[model samples]
Target: MKKGSATVAQLSEFDEIIDVRSPAEFADDHIPGAVNMPVLDDAQRARVGTIYKQVSPFEARRIGGALVAENLARHLHAHFQDKPKHWRPLVYCWRGGQRSGAFVTWLRMVGWDACQLEGGYKNFRRMVIDALAQQPATLDFRIIGGATGSAKTRILEALAAAGAQVLDLEGLASHKGSVLGALPGVAQPTQKKFETALHAVLSRFSPDRPVYVEAESRKIGRVHLPTELMEAMRGSPCFAIDASREARIEFLLRDYAYLGDDVADLQRKLGCLNRIISNETLARWQDYAAVHDLPALFTELVDQHYDPLYKRSQNSNYVRFGDAIHVSTDDLSPSGIIAIADAILAKTPVRADAR
Candidate 1:
């Protein structure tokens, strides 16, 4: 096949693909697993762009084309040149235009099949949007709501362990859904990547199995949930697992302390909190953390921060789930966890409510 001619279905079967857009564009969003191999580096891209605007398109290509060829030659030698000759590596530029198309031409000279994505990232993204639009409308969905730090995730883990088919939106998105939600060391994917990951996992779920999801808003970090999933979560039943405030507080610290013992990460994460918290409270929060008064710090955070946001989000615009249940007490105990799961099981059964 010619370069820039392969369809998405064909592209999906490849072992790998290359995206050749600007780094900024890639950072904004992209295919999750794609390795960026921009034929136009940042400096070269700017140079070409300036020429295209200030000089002339012809001069720009004359300059840009040479640089692109050199970069591709280096990529072939240092990286891809020695791989299996027939290896299927789909390549793309922003819109299956000159950049990737050019690379495919060069690759063909080297004896590789070298097909390009028909419409590049633009077309792949459209496929994702269409797939999300087709999410099962009558999914047997259930919410595993809980107070901050109740180890709701742990309970959900147990539920899945006990053979429940769970749809974990947070897990797919790599976020914990709060100011403290950033996982240790791992940067979250862009919205498009998140959507792609979500779709891949969600496709495996059957509408017949009950899927348990954490209560979340449309936005998780930089990514937003699909309209269909958010709507499904809204109409679906929610059951909150209430743990004693103390247990919740301890859990939050344990989960978040890894950011740093230095407290800078906590501050960085709290940049959003400053908008809502009083200036004095924000100052006091840092003060408390500095002195290592961890308990008091987290308590205020739960009351003034996490808990309040949770209540408002879990309440407003969100209809109270008609079918609701609770853990036995406002505390984290194994038995309490069991009771909560049992209650969820009683209310949301696989095959009928959530898939």
Candidate 2:
């Protein structure tokens, strides 16, 4: 790379990555680990855009330039005051345009080694998309398949804790993959952000070792999986978990105790299934929720909704589901889950071809 510019491929060569786009743009998506130091804030950017459209480009630039200078001075005193003179940073805006150019020029004049991203965040976004489309094929993945409430996520966590590579999609998405999967007081990330996170995690795994991930639908709540990754997971070998129904219900009751706190919201989430479940059954479930009879509600939900749906989706989507190695357990306690993870690790061997 040159003294004044770097490419997305050279991200790690810099001491810090700075995003000079507005906060809104940064929140939507940016290069992972990049810090936000917007030259123009959300309101200022909108104001400048309006001026450029309604008044004149020169007028907008004049006003925006002043605002950018003021913000840069604030950042210098507040954020960059303690930085060493030898610090090197990569700075970028939406495009390799005026905002980042101005910031980089200022930093360079201040005696720090600063470079602008050649194509800015647009380039990084392109890199993320391309990586997601191609990277899944490079890794060896093992799918953990089970009906809802079978502690698949817990098992994946245990696998990770046991020094195995694990990708917890639900943990990434912030929503469990179900109708009741919406977590209270938690919101899902934008689809682009989710893909960025997924790409980051996938990039870290060793191809020679198998990555354990839960079997997820194409969409987890509002965010959808990359088509290539979904295909990769669906075709991967699976470990089917067959925990007893009673055990599953008990597990769910404990895992989803938050749902019991808001009976009205729980009923509303269940009402979403009115189209598939008969009115009488829906009423019965609603009544159970109204009375805080979680055990009955969970049991009915598993028997009627979750189990049947899991059977159909797993069989149809997972190509290797028929040949899956079944792992049965009546115990989903913490120790038992670890034992299960240990057993799976013992059975799974690293692939020589992955290297």
Query: lDDT for every model?
Result: 0.77, 0.91
**Model 1: how far is 108 from its true place, Å?**
2.3
Task: Find the candidate with the highest lDDT and give its number.
Answer: 2
Off by over 4 Å in 2: 352-355
lDDT of 2 by residue, 1-355 (tens): 5669999899999999999999999999889889999999999999999999999999999999999999999999989988899999999999899999999999999999999999898888899999999989988999898888889999999998889999999999999989899999998999989999999999999987899999999999999999999998988988899999988999999998899899999999999999998999999999999999999999999999999988888989998889888889999888888888987888786662221
Query: What is the Å distance of residue 288 in model 1 from its true position?
Result: 1.6
lDDT of 1 by residue, 1-355 (tens): 5533698777568778778887877777777688888898888899999999999999999999999989988888888856788776788877889998888888777887778888888898898899888884756677777767877776787688777878777787788877778787778887777888887777778877778877777887667888888887787767777778877777667666665475777766666678788889889988776676777888888888778777766766346554556654564556666666666677664444432
- TM-score, each model? 0.85, 0.96
Clashing pairs in 2: none
**Cα RMSD, each candidate:** 3.3, 1.7
- TM for candidate 2 is 0.96
Each candidate's clash count:
10, 0
